[model samples]
Target: MRTLHRREAAAALLALPALALGRPAAAQNSRPVRVVVPAAPGGAIDVIGRIYATRLSEKTGSPWVTENRSGANNTVGAAEVARSAPDGKTLLINADIQLMAKRVMRAVPYDPITDFTPVARLATAPLVLVGNPAGTPNGDLGALVAAMKAAPDKFAFANSALGSMGHLSTESFKRRAGLDTLVVSYRGTAPALTDVLAGQTALMVAPLGSALPHLRADRLRAFAVFSPNRSAQAPEIPTTAEAGMPDLQFTLWYGLWGPKGMPAEVVNALNAAVREVGAEPAIRARLTEQGADPVDEDAAGFARFIGTEAERNGRVAQEAGIEPE
Candidate 1:
């Protein structure tokens, strides 16, 4: 009887963790999955997050909702997700801002690497240098560089978020080009684009997808694309190298992450759902049209990629002399 009692106690101890999780398994199926986009509605991250949520919900028979928690260079929403329970319900879908927030900010509320588990890399798109044709003299990279060098603090660069790809990539470009262009931060992409269109800001480095519509409508003109090759959606635009800023190459990438300590099985399921969505013809077509290249990395691969990206972006930030806020 004594031995049986000890065995039963060990079994209970083993089951305690699962019991304490309060339906971690149910999160994958029964409950709604909330994907948190740490930006305003019109940004590239928000656009992709909505697409993924809609497709994943339809594919998996589990409702997925996108919640915008924009502010503080993405920290406000990130911290909220970080502090959430580690069940699969709450997730984060963001861009390179995830890796850059800590490197560019003075006091980050959550650890970009340790506070979350990377679930999968969804897609990557080149950052395009766009200018309002009405404001820019030549509407080309060489002219823009020359203009910045000629007039210090005369031109303003607009960024949707403080630590976003637009911010980091523009800073790096400035450092490399030996230019002193003033950076202007806006609440989100919509406002930033509005200012750019209205000629309030001279230039903006943004995700190709976010700038595509304006470029097509002639509201904004593409100067250079920050990729080794021109994007399929806008092949007429020259690469940064061809446009005379060879070293200013940067790509905007998006991925999914859940709060730290989420179960491996749940992570795997989410990754599989993303892969399935990527395989759909319509989804792939839409992503391609938006200048994104679909990626199908699993959870472990995504984690490793995030680790490397954080290290690389930290080095870039240090090199650019961008002091944390």
Candidate 2:
């Protein structure tokens, strides 16, 4: 009888963890998944994160919550996610900043490439190349290039953040154009656009949504969009390829990630959840309204893209001589 009692006690111990959490561990699907958005509460990133969170909850019949963990240029929240368990319960929804954390800051605690499993790519925000009216009145890409080449010393590019995709895209353009123009970094898009508006800066590669009002008001001249196709919001602007800079294209994108070595099933389940939710017509329309285009790549495909992007970013950083702050 004592032996039987001991066996029963062992069985109870085995059941404790599952019961204590109020759910089984099959999909890590037993409880609410916490999605950490490693940026501020406003802006397209936060809005998109919230939309995904709500949609995932409805589509999966599981609860998902998004928490803002904005700091250290998004590395603080990312490091926290990297240290989390690979249970799929705690996840991260961060921007491309996650890819270049170490390249931009010294205190990054995790390798962006290996420390997390890629779940899905959320969306890509297209960019526009604009010049202050005072600097480039004609808004012609060909003429602007010639002028910049003639007086490269007079041109300065303003990007919102140091390691942002816009900044990297600008650097790539500089190399392709073979001009050594100065790039000035600012805290946010508004201030950078303000400077460009006032002609304190000569040019800026800005998000189409953020720069649309200024462009509509004719405060800034649209030179070319750094995208493969023209944006629906600003169809008048030519793409980089149309402007004769075919090799220069980059975008600010967002992705979901789980800790390293999560069970393959868990990753697939979450990936499916994201895909299902993203496919909803309503969700797609909402994303479009936010100046972002939906992405539809699976986990492995997303990982490969990240590797390619990291390579491109590395080249840009090397060329620009970016040192970690």
Candidate 3:
């Protein structure tokens, strides 16, 4: 009995606040609430999730910790959350990729909308079109488009994932520019950027935060930013509107969510916590450093926005002939 008790205690220590180890918010316990980031650690969403979790722990007097569950373009983590108890103990912080699972892949496990409750929109980052300096002519978008149109068979774009903001936005841009080129989907951004830097691919629409350092280091060239105005980090770059691609409009946003059927009070409390964290100057500064604009929005508002975005993206994918894989 003594040896069995020791083994059980060791197992409990190892599980120290990960997965769905904690009880529901209604039935509180000493275990910490797990804030799941559906992406690997040290990535954009993981960084933001950690920041929010740290602040939420202090703000709500509840121990909150971040847990990573990355795979299948967020399907693995999202499905796990959908199956978890609709308690406040397990939460999700994911990017706009949350809505694109159905449109991009054929074997998604859950409905992105109905399986989860949208809590609040945390931040948004502008997407920029970037190309290798040596790969394109004279670092100009017009020149690149002309050359791509002239020889449509040679050039292709690289996207980090199938349903990522980078992928869909680039496809939309290709359609708008009237180019019939291939878009190679890599497993992640680092590998895709590697190919772009090596001229294996011609261009990619990446989040400003991910591309800014490379652009600053002279490793890549900026063709356009998919926004109304220039990014303050790279003010020298022109907007998509300025580049004469005004039809391409998209922003990479991060949001908070939980399993469906969570109590309204729990959802509202989490939403309020996000807003309070968003309003902090320190938090805003951190997000700004990451090239994101923090946003303040309610749950219902975010839900409506998700519906609109999903519909638009689905239409765009269909028009671009992006079939599920």
Candidate 4:
């Protein structure tokens, strides 16, 4: 009995150092994090970033600051984040434009996959096809397709920018319908939608959130929405699949990312905080109001999703023969 007791005590003594070492590491807390918004102020990305920053700060007991660094189609801000220290103190909040930028531009400074690590996916907003109510045959998707096909080169589609989500969706629609519509690129969605309203342009593909007011006012007619499922806010509008085009699966999803080499513990901490924020009722409500659906995804899943998006955009750009602006 004496020998057995000694052995047990010896084993307990050997475990003390590990327990002591583990406690300090586990107790370590992160400092305030800075979230970089890769767009101008008053944009959807900025709004989402601010909301996420506020919630993450509250949940982690660490301040989160949103910094807008807009330029170069979000490449300037993304590059800044990629060059920042990988200590979890700096994060990037952006949308699908990042992937399309890489696909269209040949002079990107950093690699999209290698320079940063995905932290989490926050939300997704679907795109909708809208046309001026005062215009030609445009009551439904089939009518619009028929009009575009009949005119071919005369029909024009407006887009937010040269390589934006709106541009890609319009291009995909043209390809799917085997039509030859002229693509008119504007500086932003507001200008493009303005042109469509003023009868300057015939049609456009814009975010459902941005088009909701116009749709409700009857200024624009929504023919189809680009999403895997129908939107709850606008269930009357049919999805692209129901419109007979299942290949048009696209959404403007927002996510968080950090520079490469971020520590595993820090990544885990940020993921937990983001997931909590996404699951909150207030956050979900805000997202719904913005025409965005909250999506809870971890680092690994988001990273994989990014990879797939990059590849898919690349293929689409190639097929469209899109040139950099």
Candidate 5:
């Protein structure tokens, strides 16, 4: 009995170091993590958030749940996360929209660059220019551009919302391509795609993952992708440069963020967890299959990337002629 007691005490002592580090113990004992995704469920951002949440729960042995607080081009949920206690319990999973919100909105409650500490950049998906095949008889980009130039006001373009990446990318395309496509904004990607399918909207620049199904079904036509190279998922679709618009580049990127002042230990632990999970072959393959390239950047690296993105996207917003609303 004495020997058994000693062994038990030793085991508990061994766990003390881990508990102090706050990896498995903190998450397990704390309230369930609330991951806020500033977009509607079923969109690419939401899907990526769910994946990371599930994997994070598995890694830390904690229950992580996602809450959709979509509105104001992703500012609503972002603001919520920003206002949350910086205990690492509440997190935000968002994309480029977070950076562009300030540029296009008259006033955003939270400063995306300073209000949160970046944890990791999960994945990035290139945007694609798609249209209804029936409406766009010429499937190539050049043909589509010529058609739009021929009759500028006759055709309409759709985007998720005014301050969204879709909106920014399309606006940039119009300016760069010199096409006078009218803008049609929707509450979310589903409605925007719905309008496109119904032919109410002629074209849209959206994430390739969301548009892949329709493209496969032949309901929509993919003219060009915005990436520098053709996507493995859809090699048939040429790149924008190949289609004569090399300067047009926009990618839908997803990253994790916590309220400002989260402990460095917690941030480091979460960053390591994301990188470990992202390195798994199965997860990598799955993200790739969905037209996303999983990125393994840490907190500092992601923060720097966000800075660069903000600067570049700011230029995009200005050139798009989209005034703050």
Candidate 6:
């Protein structure tokens, strides 16, 4: 009887390991996924992040939350996400400025390429060249380029930050056009746009979504759009390429990324969730309303896209003599 009892006890102990392994890990799928936005609450980046969060939650059967950590031109939030666990739970709804331009500007806490894995490309939008409707001398791209070329140092352009995408795009324009113009850097886009509209600044380059309402209301004049093609939201406006400047093609994009080395299953699941959410009719409408084109590329595609962007922007920065701030 004793020998039989010992054998049964040993068998029970061996089965215990299998039973524990069969059960779900503690809170692995239950914890909420965090989506970090590197911009302020009322900005386009925040809006995009929120939309993704909602759709991801619905598709994944898990709670996804958007956390705004706006500072350092979006580096703060981006760094936070880069340092997070290599799990799909923490994600960054990163803008081009944070993911691409910030690295060129200064030495950040994390590596943009090696530290994070790209999950999906969310949206792409044109950058609009806008000017004060009242005092601006030029009405169109040709006229503006001519005016700047005629008196190089006389014309002034305002930008949100020194090394920001808008600033770089404007610099590219200047270099390609062989024109010299003064650049004024501001703390943020809101203040810069306010100054431009108030006629305090001659011109500014802003994303189409931010410039659309003003353009439609006639508060500002649209000079040229920096995009491969003209925007559907404002089809009447000509693209930079159409304006006789093919070299000025640049688009502001946003995407999702997490820390590198994330589980393959988790990455696939997140990619599917983003694709589903981005394709939803309501989400599409909302993005279209904001003058953004929704994109839903998988991890490899997004990674390749980001790599290309980084190389392109790096060249622009080097050619334009853009020094790190």
- Candidate closest to the true structure, highest TM-score: 5
Clash number for every model? Answer: 0, 0, 0, 0, 0, 0
TM of each candidate vs. truth: 0.89, 0.79, 0.86, 0.82, 0.90, 0.84
Per-residue lDDT tens digits for candidate 2, residues 1-325, read 0122444433322322433244434324445778887766654567788988887665454567888876776777888888887777789997776788889888778988899989899888888889988887595788888899999877899877768788888888888888889999765566677889898999998877667778889888999888888889788889999988887888878899988876655666667667766777999898877678778888989999999999988887898777799
Clashing residue pairs found in predicted model 2: none
Give one digit per residue, the lDDT tens place, for model 1 in 127-237. Answer: 898988876766577788887788766678999887777887889888878887789998777788889989999889988888899999999988898899988899899
Please provide, for model 6 over 1-325, each residue's C-alpha lDDT reduced to its tens digit, 9 standing for 90 to 100.
0122444433322312222344323323566778898776756677777877876566545567889886766778888988777656688986777545454557778777788888888888788998887756646788888877887665688886666689889899889888788888765566677788888888898878878889999999998889888788999888888888887877878888887776555666567667767788999998887788789788888888888888888888888888777
Give per-model CA RMSD. 6.2, 6.9, 7.1, 9.1, 6.9, 8.8
Q: Global lDDT of each model?
A: 0.80, 0.78, 0.79, 0.77, 0.80, 0.75
By TM-score, the better pick of 1 and 3 is 1
lDDT of 5 by residue, 1-325 (tens): 0122444433322322333355566445545778999887777888778887887776666778899988887888999999887666789998878777767788888887888989899999988999987677565888888888888876788888777788888988889887777898776677788889899888888789889989899888999998899998999999989987778877888899988876666677678778887888888887876788889888889989998988888878777888887
Instruction: Find the number of clashing residue pairs for candidate 5.
Output: 0
| Candidate 6 accuracy as TM-score | 0.84
* Better candidate number, 3 or 4, judged by TM-score: 3
Model 1 pairs whose backbones collide? none
What are the runs in model 3 whose C-alpha is more than 4 Å off?
1-29, 198-200
Using lDDT as the yardstick, the better of models 5 and 6 is 5
Error (Å) of candidate 6 at residue 91 is: 1.3
Residue-by-residue lDDT tens digits, candidate 3, 174-198: 8888889888876556667778889
Residue 213 CA displacement from its true place in model 5, Å: 1.2
Which order, best to worst by lDDT?
5, 1, 3, 2, 4, 6
Q: Lowest-lDDT window of 10 residues in candidate 6?
A: 11-20
Task: List candidate 4 segments past 4 Å from native.
Answer: 1-32, 152-155, 186-191
